[model samples]
Target: MSKAITNNQSVDLISDFKEITKMRLAVSVVFSSVAGYFLGAEVIDFVELLLLAVGGYMMVGASNAFNQVIEKDLDVLMDRTKNRPIPSGRMSVKKALFIAFTFTILGLLVLYIINPVTAMFGAISIFLYVSIYTPLKTKTPLSVFVGAFPGAIPFMLGWVAATNDFSIESGTLFMIQFFWQFPHFWALGWWLYNDYKRGGFFMLPTGKRDRGTAIQIILYTIWTIAVSLIPVFGVTGRLYLTPVSGILILILGLGMLYYAYKLYKNRDEISAKKLMFASVSYITLLQIIYVLDKYIRIWI
Candidate 1:
């Protein structure tokens, strides 16, 4: 009976840590970094790849933890976030801060071992997310725009980790991910607008389900697609995509655009949710295509 109680406590602790750190989101960030590393790599180094994934996850996890600490009160006002560890009272603010500080120091140290540039960007991402984006969320709708800077870093950070240098190829990766965030986030913003409003947060551009916001989403979708295809022009150095791969990516873009149009046409919660899923699908599948295309080209 005593052993059972101890096991239960351990499980609860793990669950609380996961909630505080946003385990799924952190893993997705790590996935983006790994995909970027693969794209820029000449020969895969398993050791370096492992370090990048570990360091990347730690940085993202630290960011999420800090964000929750900042938004603890606001989070309680929203249904979606009320159950999160800090807001739910399952985890104390002191404990969460300890995790955040530890992760930040150790994460930067690990990244610095890779290269100063990679560590520098990692620090910038943390600063932007925690210091800039977290506070700005309640103040202005432009927070998403500011947040996208750090959100887009994981992919580009991977390239820098592998190459130890930032070049046109790395910039192109950053720009593609940067544009992709608007549609991805705005769709999420649309569906979660009510919850966000409850927290006194500014999410959507207009802060309402209006034609203006939908129009902007559609426009950004087009821009994202256009940027994704830039590599096909043989202009992005080592990041060039073949025509066949370009067509596949274009198809993915059109699929995402279709959902954005659906949201624009319907302006309903359901359509907004669909757009959110579509955007996620687009980014995940696009990364797969990029990695596969590069490896296939090398083999051929």
Candidate 2:
């Protein structure tokens, strides 16, 4: 009976790890990181790509694990989060902490093996996300600014990993993702106001889905579009935007903005959810365009 109980406990541990790490979210974040790597890399190395996927996934997993550890108490307050492993009593605090540290160390080691700069940035991202942004989320809305730093790093992290150094190109990659987050997150805040409020997470600048917040979202949406088109003006180095590509990008940006404005004008839950979905579509489509544009020019 004791041996059978031990076996059952082992299976439960594995299950709890998956739940605590938010495996789905972790996988999506790593997918974005891999997509960035493909866009930035001149040569698609299978081994390097594997390393990137592993390191990126573990880094994100570590951040999320630490986040859950810190917010265990608050997680129980939110309806959407209360079923999480930590808050639901499926995972112990000590076990979660151990997993977080293990992933953090292994992720840094994997990135370092790939390239030192990659490891450095990976470490920095983990530090910022776990130490600063996660704790600040409940304290102030400025946490969004803090959170964006780590959130945007994956775009440039891939560049540095591929090139083994930072460059203006990497900065440009960072800028694109950095500007994209404000409008994306604000839309989520608009739609999930009650859910976020329950946990004391101040996700919006105004803390209310009002005209002021909506206006900021629209302004940032415009900036996201403009920055995306900068390559067309011949200012973004090897990242050229042909007239056709530029036009397409502009259309997509405007589509995103159209919904942002609609949400602002309507200030309704339905509109907010629409804008939130649009924001997800915007990022995914923009990345696809970047990759497709590169391939199209190569084949032409």
Candidate 3:
């Protein structure tokens, strides 16, 4: 091959790798793990935290790669996903499978270095996302409900990695994220209903962007907000939340709820998009608050 053509091919390969892995989303998911680690660790071990982040990203990336492979054909029908590596013919199924397996193994090994339980959760996450959730997408809208299990694991996985135990604290973390995803994803689903329909994805709970879906989104947003504040209660044990932090989280949740309410009233794509962004901001800020609260409480 000519030198110029070879360089172009290399660039394409790099781009394809990013697309298959959904790099940005993977990093965001890993951030949730880092937040969980902060809550679990008594004395911060930077090395363990680094390992958790890397391993978490790898597992998430592997799941995305496998998802793209399984949905290659359906992906091509949707504008949002038609340009992905496999759907666009930029990557082969064989190569993508190789990457997925490699990531799964390496990710599990890294998590195992932390603790056996952590590694087990990592394995479970991949299995759910790839084997169960991915297949259920076209078949039922309940796929999101199932997918939330793997989605919720990263935050709890971090806590499990640090403590080497699954406690009510970790379960609280899982429940918070689990409830949070409904409004978040349904908002995105509302905005992209047409696109998802083209891909045969059952995203909406009621399978339509009607009042039923909007009302559920509002209800779930409320539930997500409630779950996030559970740490303030004594039931969560070590995962304590001060009144000030609780107030802050409440405000953030209210903001997200406001957006959801808007979507309900407007029942338009624009409103849905706004709610989706708001939900993302709420969860991310919620993590930041939890981490900062933990450290601040320690210092003071």
Candidate 2, which segments miss by more than 4 Å at Cα? 1-15
lDDT of 3: 0.93
Per-prediction TM-score, please?
0.99, 0.93, 0.98
Alpha carbon RMSD to native, model 2 = 2.3
Alpha carbon lDDT of each predicted model: 0.93, 0.86, 0.93
lDDT of candidate 3 over 1-300, digit per residue (tens): 699999999999998888888999999999999999999998888999899998998899899999998999999999999988887777899999999989999999998998899999999999999999999999999999999999999889989989999999999999999999999899999999999999889999999999999999999999999999988987898998988999999999999999999999999999999999999999999999999999998899
Q: Which pairs of residues collide in candidate 3? A: none
Pairs in steric clash, model 1 = none
Error of 2 at 169 (Å): 1.3
Residue 238 in model 1: shift from native, Å? 0.5
Error of 1 at 46 (Å): 0.9
